[model samples]
Target: MSKHEILIVDDEPANLQKLKRTFLTDYTVHEAKTGDEALLILKERPVVAIVTDQRMPGMSGVNLLRQAREVRPDSIRIILTGFTEVEYLMDAINQGQVHRYITKPWEPVALKEALRQEIERWQLRKENERLSEELRLANEQLEKENFRLRQEIESLEPAGKQLVYESQEMRELMRLIDRVVPTNSTVLIQGETGTGKELLARYVHDQSPRADQPFIPVNCGAIPSELIESAFFGHKKGSFTGAIENRKGHFELAHQGTLYLDEIGEAPLDLQVKLLRVLQDAEIMPVGAQVAKKVDVRIIASTNRVLSREVEAGRFRQDLFFRLNVFAVFVPPLRTRRDDIVALSRYFLDRCRRRLNKPIPSFDPQTLALLRGFDWPGNVRELENEVERMVILSEPDQPIPASMVSERVRLASSTGGSDAGGLKEKVAEFERSLILEALRRHGHNRSHAADALGISRQTIIAKLKQYQLDDETAEG
Candidate 1:
């Protein structure tokens, strides 16, 4: 800790010496014979506390304390006075802002205690301000990191990556994702189904050093329990009754690349042990083969299940859990990233139009509002599907009606509820309205609508799909 400086201003040389001696051991004491001299010293140095005599030639102790407050508002002030006048004390308290008043013939211990307490208060205030500054800086850094991560995710130009969201928590998580992406660390991504866990995993792989290599995705839950090992480790020709020829496992194919093991919590306990061995040794033993083959594969595992609970229940190996948890990233569900919903919706709509080779349709105000209000349990994937459905159903020149959207989604525009729920619903409603207004301004032309929204034509189509406002069946 830096030394605390105390300024003492008194006309009498003896009194200045006495007070200086009392605090010299615990603090750095600067003594002055007059208030003007003390002010000069204060201007030159950083003083944490000030002690002044009430009676002086040019300036009183109260006036000096008030001046000290202007220079250092946080500085502790003490007044030393012989007068017992109530008016003087009141003026000292009001103008000089004295923290404590010391009468003539003061007790040494009492004076020391008062000085110590004043010093403590000053230190505490400084410390709190410092901590607050640090927290603000930390939050800013986290937001930048999240922004970079989101950009990286958008660079993928995935099917549904056009949503706009303003969640601090999600931004922090995105920053964590960026930090862990460059290394070959095993990442465990957790979230509910459709929460874009796979998108996050893919982002990690794409941004990693092994971006040039293949990204092999495996759904652990999709594979049969009996064929788990053979599927992961490969099988030699005639190794088993169905093994017609030698086939390489996902591990071999993913050499020097990323293997996204989705739904890893569903893997059987026996397979978990094998998976652990592969992760630890960087080698795999193929089915019906005695030798273990070394491979350079980066593991990016994801699961919606709570693995800690699984470990506690003996369903997942604790050792394996630790190995895969070198970096843990949680993808927030759609409800958490509402800021990105409109952007994502527009992106999906555009993609659907491109794929269907049809002109993109416009979204009605009510329809856009309903899309935002819906609770997307299925996440980005669900949103994409909904958008595609709408695009195929609506006509090229027609605007999608709000009546087509489910009532549950429409309720998002309603007033009052839980803070999280209400905010999400309101944002959704706002997004819907914005999109419709843009479409109306552009005369239902997707290209013009995109321009009006200050986004690309492709982005508008994606948005249309995300809101489920396709133009397939509308009157052209």
Candidate 2:
């Protein structure tokens, strides 16, 4: 994310420097010696606030600001004036959206505090506009769903919480989802934990033809082995002890809709066979039922583990893996999509601000910078949790401060912008860190690290050479 900006205009170079020093910590300061210079800057860059001296040589501050409204209508316009310029301040207020007017020879601390408040107000307004735009786009997409599937499913948790993407990686992922959703084939989503695989699956379902139907998400790892069959295929009344009433299993519940199998790699061998049968035949037999029932269900499965490795290790069924892998989508981790960090943060901040019913605006610029600096190992879920916590700790009518941010994030920023880099650099850093940790755990043995990573020893050797870590490897 780019830095928040403040434009300080004054004919006197000393005064401009003073004003710049006041906000150098919180904003990227732009200095101008004349109204024309400031106007030229406005054309090129957007600013959060414009502070101009009321008395200038040619064009007065009020006239310059009035003209600036056409360029940056959302910017907060302020004028530093003397008592003699009260009349000009009124004209500025009436003609432009002048936020405030401070008398000449103002206290630097007081002016700084006033500007911080206005900056927060500007940030909140911009974030709100962004969120409203997202909602508008979501409604438009719902309309394009052809108006047939717009009933109860409109309230599905994916509405306001849908995938928000700014990075090209996520944009390409969404495009792939669009291409595959029309096919209605079983989709296997792969990603690390907290990468929002389930949300992506629901998004895929919402784009499918069976959108209005129920979306049943079942965690294969959470169910006990004994009750697994009953949970998937259901049981008739009195099918077994404590089975007092008939139950509709997930497949039946999601008939004509989507059945999301989360953590699919954790499914037992028997369960995998049953899943493969259902996928092939589109039919299921209830426990203790005499006949099979046909059902229309689409499969969307997600797993954190590498399923191919799971199959090779005899922990997963090869046939089931093949069936689900017909269509695949990968949700990239947060650290790899650094550009989306600020956009997603603002999205969550808007949600939490409304839900809590507080006047707390957005995060201070430094706080946001610190947030971007930290590598979100837990991904989107962890970011949301951190935002919610910061919102709760914030005071009304103020932005969340850097002091309120998590200590780990603060520590990350202590290196002074060390996290500044592009996607390839970040991804390579993450991969290198993982390889180093794996080697450390295996006493720096490259062979064991390769095995644990599901790669050949030769490939690990190449990676170690590429990362210049060959010298760190364990010697036989």
Task: Give per-model TM-scores.
Answer: 0.55, 0.56
How close to the true structure is residue 179 of candidate 1, measured as C-alpha lDDT? 88
Clashing pairs for predicted structure model 2, backbone only: none
Runs in model 1 with CA error above 4 Å?
Answer: 1-169, 411-476
lDDT of 1 by residue, 1-476 (tens): 66788888888888888888888888888999887888899889898888888889998888888888887888898888885754677766765488888888777678889999888887788899999999867964664455455646656544434324456767788788888888888889999998778777877887799876767889987888789889999988888899997777889777777899999999888889989999889999989898999999999899999999999998999999999888887888887767666667777767887778777655654565566666788887888787888888877856666665655555644543666456445556576667677677666777766766556677667767887875453221
Candidate 2 achieves a global lDDT of: 0.82
Q: What range of 10 consecutive residues in model 1 has the weakest lDDT sum?
A: 157-166
After superposition on all C-alphas, the RMSD of every candidate to the true structure, in Å, is: 26.0, 31.3
Question: For candidate 1, what is the TM-score?
Answer: 0.55
Evaluate model 1: give its lDDT: 0.78
